[model samples]
Target: SQTIHQWPATLVQPVGSPLSLECTVEGTSNPNLYWYRQAAGRGLQLLFYSVGIGQISSEVPQNLSASRPQDRQFILSSKKLLLSDSGFYLCAWSEFVAGAVNNEQFFGPGTRLTVL
Candidate 1:
């Protein structure tokens, strides 16, 4: 029984401020973790991913960064937030599937951030 959790369900920050969002997974080991963002009424955009501890892959060149501090914990951070950074941030985890080409991902409830 794997579970993922995200904190500070909603956030409001001024432009140029720093940001930090946390995610944690329980009941799993070495699972692939992902960070995605979705604008209002738009599709999801993958921001970062991790295959293992200390291994991260960024999918886009943006003002955001992610880190795996522990086996079950992941964090997303930004040194200076931008106006366009306002969106829904999601954290997801998935395990490798033996037969399926792509693993099925399970997502967290998500955190909504508003920049002003």
Candidate 2:
């Protein structure tokens, strides 16, 4: 029974402000974590992922960064938010099954950020 949690369901921040978003998982151990962003009507874009604690992989170069301080915790941060940073941020987790063809991920209720 794994569950992922994301905070601050919605946010509105001025441009150039700092940003921090958090995600945590319960009932699982050493699961693969992921961060995704979805703009208005676009598909989910992979942002960052972690295989384990202190291990982060970025899928694309962007104005944001991610960190994993613990096995079940992941954080996304930006020193200065940009106008393009506004979007829906989603956190997901999947079981680490070796050689598996597909790892079904469970996603959290995303946080909608608006930069004005």
lDDT of each residue in 5-95, candidate 1, tens digit only:
9998999999999999999999988888999999995999999999889999999999999999898899999999999999999999998
Candidate 1 wrongly placed segments (more than 4 Å) = 97-102
For model 2, name the residue pairs that clash. none
Tens-digit lDDT string for candidate 2 (44-99): 99999999999999999999999999999999999999999999999999999878
Global fold similarity of model 2 (TM-score)? 0.96
Top model by lDDT, which number? 2
Which candidate wins on TM-score?
2
TM-scores for all predictions = 0.94, 0.96
- Shift in Å, residue 94, candidate 1: 0.3
Provide the lowest-lDDT 10-residue window in model 2: 95-104
